[model samples]
Target: MSRHHDVVVIGGGQAGLAAGYHLRRLGLDFVILDARTTPGGAWQHTWGSLRLFSPAAYSSLPGRLMPPQEGQTYPDGAHVIEYLTEYEQRYGLPIVRPVAVDAVRRDGDRLRVESGSGEWRARAVISATGTWWRPFMPAVPGRAEFEGTQLHTVEYRRPADLAGQRVIVVGGGNSGAQIAADLAHETDLTWVTQRPPRFLADDIDGRALFDHATARRRALDEGRTDTGGVASLGDIVAVPPVREARDAGLLKAQPMFARMTATGVEWADGTTAEADTIVWCTGFRPALSHLAPLGLRGPRGHIPTAGTRALGEPRLHLLGYGDWTGPASATLIGVGRPARDAARAIAELLAEA
Candidate 1:
């Protein structure tokens, strides 16, 4: 007989873990299905030096508090993974790892989730696989003909890997800045961006500005008071570490490239630069291929779920869909409110059923 569950959550990352934790508290029968061998999702795949911009206070899972890191401004990736592993052990949440989901389809009134080893049926499903599923790489003319190494920021590991190479870092986001700054110590680097960057201030005193936005977002979600629009890093968050690279001239800002040639990149301003490696720090796309029949995606292929309604699907919901009513939607802190709200909504649905 095939295994059955009350609810099945895909992806064992922070979002999925949050949902599983709440389901357990509600006394619901559920199981968490993950592709990786362990929890922490993308954090495990990130560069070893990665850390959360938000403080430890805001990074905790549902019931447990993240261990105190008094003097550290941000918790590193290893710390995050350690905390998540502890959270799993504390709750004894059922998580099946190394199981890659092949497809998820609604069959009659039940949803079928198939993996290489077996299949699972559930009355409801939570697609908690976060947005970083797919990395976005822009198509530059003649890119295929370039005689050099090329990789996405997602693939970059450490600055030592780029030693003695002429590197061009593309995109102006936090990852781009941090990577560029780190690489400047060992390589000839140039930072290229299409838009002028909007910088945020470093953590003030001991409080991170990201914490304030997350708090406000939670309040607005709970219907406390009208907190106004979603927050952008442009307003308060400090410019990331890349600004230091610009000051040292190791990194020179340039416009979006007009085109790419076999020899080098051509900027819109009619200038050119040669590079041995190109790192595209572009961005990411939501991973929702498993949610095909829902018909929820917009023109850009992102799900159109609004205000945690699950886009009108029965017992189907999302936790961190991106800035629903607040300024930031992609951060770990930003997703907490929605995760809690999603849990409550699922509990209510189970009650009604």
Candidate 2:
């Protein structure tokens, strides 16, 4: 028999789990469909060297705080995965694992979530799929002809794998900076960004950024005219490793190369440099191919969302993509608020039904 739920939350990552936490509190019959076999969501696939930009206390979901191990401060990817596993057990969120949602189509008054395992019919659906599946790399001229070891930040795992290689780390975001710092210890790495990278103040971390986001969101909501300057999370946080690299004179960044050569890259000034590997730290797009059939995506391939709720499709809500869906919804500390609001919106819809 086909299963049915009042609400179906796709992608059991931080965003989906946050929504599930709220839905459970609202007494709604909902299920979270996770593509991964385990409970950590995309964190399970993250590189071993990856750690949260903030401390454990600041990077938590709605209900439970991520408890760190003895003497541990900023949690690594493994710590997050363990916490997520424990969070699911603590709340007993109704989650089905290893279920890849293929497509969501309108089924009369409800939406049908068709996955590889089975089908779930629900009146409301929340897409909390973070952008792990959609790692993007820009098209460098003649990139296809370059015969080199090219990997994105998603495929990269160990720093030792890049040891002794002339690597070009692309993107000015936090990931690129961190990865460059990691590789610099054992290898020759050239940092490449479209523009110069901005390093955040030493005191500022994810917590402070989230606080800023909250204040700005509040000001926008209240129609206040005095809007203050906000910082992007992409700005490099002077973490211990990054600082160490900076002190060692490894934080030097290079301008983006004009094009790719068979051996390496060509500079805008007609300079040539050879590299063994290219680690593109370019960001991701929303994993919204499943929702493509609904004809809701705009020109940029994003659904127009009004605070987590789809603009035209009230029955649909998108969480944890970026600022458009909600304030800082893409961060660990950022996803909770939007997920909570989405739950409330879906609860109101369910009540009307």
Please list the C-alpha lDDT of all candidates, in the order they appear.
0.73, 0.88
Q: Residue 44 of candidate 1: its Cα lDDT?
A: 86
**Candidate 2 residue 159 C-alpha distance from true site, Å:** 1.5
Tens digits of per-residue lDDT, candidate 2, 58-120, equal: 999987888875655668888998888989889999889899999999999999999879999
Candidate 2 TM-score over all chains jointly: 0.97
**Colliding pairs, model 2:** none
Candidate 1's residue-wise lDDT over 1-353, tens digit each?
A: 46898888888888788778888887889999999997788888887555566668776766887886655656777888888888888999899988777777777777788889699998788787776768888988878988999888779999889899988888877677767777888888888887765556554411355556656767876989755442344522333444466566665567778777776788777788898999998888777787776566666876656665556576677665466422343565555556666667777877787
Task: Identify the runs in model 1 with alpha carbons over 4 angstroms from their true place.
Answer: 69-71, 204-252, 293-295, 324-329
Output the worst ten-in-a-row residue range by lDDT, candidate 2.
Answer: 225-234
Q: What TM-scores do the predictions have?
A: 0.88, 0.97
Model 1 / residue 153 / CA error / Å: 1.7
Q: What is the Cα-based TM-score of model 1?
A: 0.88
Error (Å) of candidate 1 at residue 186 is: 0.9
- Which portions of model 2 miss their true places by more than 4 Å? 226-229, 232-234
